[model samples]
Target: MDNNSCGCNVCSTREDLPWEGRGTDLPIAGCRFTLYPMTDRYVDIILGSLEKTDTSYVWSETDALSTVYRGKLPYVADAVKALFVNAYRSGVHMALEGQFSKGCPGDIAGDSLLEKDGEAPNAKSAEGIHFPVKCKLALYPMGVGNYIDDIAKVWYMAQDRGLEPTTIHYATRISGDVHDVFDYLRDVCALMDESAVSHYILHFTVNCNSPTKE
Candidate 1:
């Protein structure tokens, strides 16, 4: 009858969650990803890598299908990238499928969207103002994967063009000029198509708006 040994979801505790008592008040971003291992070694590598993450992030593991991270935009991005880097370093072929969001159209608890302070910004505000752009991305065969190289290329392309890109888990959020944002996305899709391996599937979505926007 002990809850700890019962393995019941209902008996599980979320009181330790970073946002447990805090309502969705802070402007934050989040992402969820399913890590697919080409080999069983991925589990250890992932767990080891996670233990090494130094940032303060709200992470939740759901069985074996996926894990979610929530925090400020930069922290979330860093944690995701750190995990990916460790997985790659382990030399295991892996794939990640996930969604990223910031300022989307729904309640944070229900939609997994990033929290924002106000409504969506206008064109005038957008001109000089930077905003979050949620994106979904998948990369397969992690170590020496074709998709990895292509993604690196796109990342550099964004930087070279003066865009602010934050990678969250398997997804990314890029903020900058709207034209630059779309252009980066266009190039990413093109590169993925051009460099994808036979065993890979690349899928993603880009949502550009504050999650709290009306």
Candidate 2:
């Protein structure tokens, strides 16, 4: 055990104890998500999306309520983005709610994914897919002081990316192309200060192809 390593869950959750490191070290990441496509063909949409998206670099498990995908950060993001985009339809409304987490103590169930190599298999196939989506994300930078400032930084990044963010009570809502929205969310997870905030979580909800006016 090094100076940065800790054994207690409380310390890890409170971020009072640091782990080996999250940067470049490739700490495990995961997201559990549920997708709702508001159309009679929702069953087809869900099944088709799952079949179309590649999960070669990620480990995934699905059940009645939601699906959990875990792996290296980038691969996880790739899988997530591909899944949502593959399921999108021009006329039907679709929504996905997900909880993303990284560096949780004892979260090694998907450690095997680290052994897999190469880029996310879905990355190449998902290219050039574009559609509009409305998204809001609540980022929790665990144990970091001035956390609100960090959140504001993400908001600013969204604006810079032309996402058109709107401040809501608990989360910041942004609207833009699905590709950009997913990329921004992925960038947030990858670009944060890994040493300062060891464990961070994001509650994200995104919807697309909606009939309702906004």
Candidate 3:
């Protein structure tokens, strides 16, 4: 068979096909983020909190820097939100930075491919691609005292409206439907101004594109 003939719906005889046209479905998508506990007490609380059972995600912690969670988009978001909420309830200052992508980006998690007919394709296979939604985010608890509580108020408000966030040096990367990403951002912004903190900070970068292009 010719290089252009893969005998699959994904393959066409056009070498000039744009990356987006190559495939629309991806098998695995995820995000990477770093959690920052502003104080020693907050650090301990955050680390200890992660020690609990969380079957919804495949997560890893690196001593005192960050944690990487890989799994379905919804599960990842839920896990991050729960962590933030629980940490805030402890009354400690904290922040989270992250990035989310639908298709494999550097295979940071190492599970970017799926087996197909006893072999894995060298490139992204449409059979396993998830919907393409990419976003970057950051969450910070402001003020010196009672900041966690202040941030918590905004956190829940964002949740009430719906937002999920993550970081730089460390980032929480997530990929999914375009609408879902937008909804997450909208909620984050809504809480930025309502928090009790003197100045709550939230940062975001969003992209909707194919894995190949990302």
lDDT, model 1? 0.47
lDDT tens digits by residue: candidate 2, 1-214: 2223333455545654343342334567889999999989999999999989998888889899999888888898899999998998887899999988875543544343777778678888888888889998999876566778878888898999999998999889999888899999998887664435576788999998777875
Q: Which lDDT values do the candidates have, in the order given?
A: 0.47, 0.81, 0.44
Question: Which of candidates 1 and 3 reaches a greater TM-score?
Answer: 1
Error of 3 at 76 (Å): 1.2
Candidate 1 weakest ten by summed lDDT: 1-10
- The TM-scores of all predictions, comma-separated, are 0.41, 0.85, 0.40
Between 2 and 3, whose TM-score is larger? 2
* Top-down TM-score ranking: 2, 1, 3
Q: For this target, which candidate reaches the highest lDDT against the unseen true structure?
A: 2
Candidate topping TM-score:
2
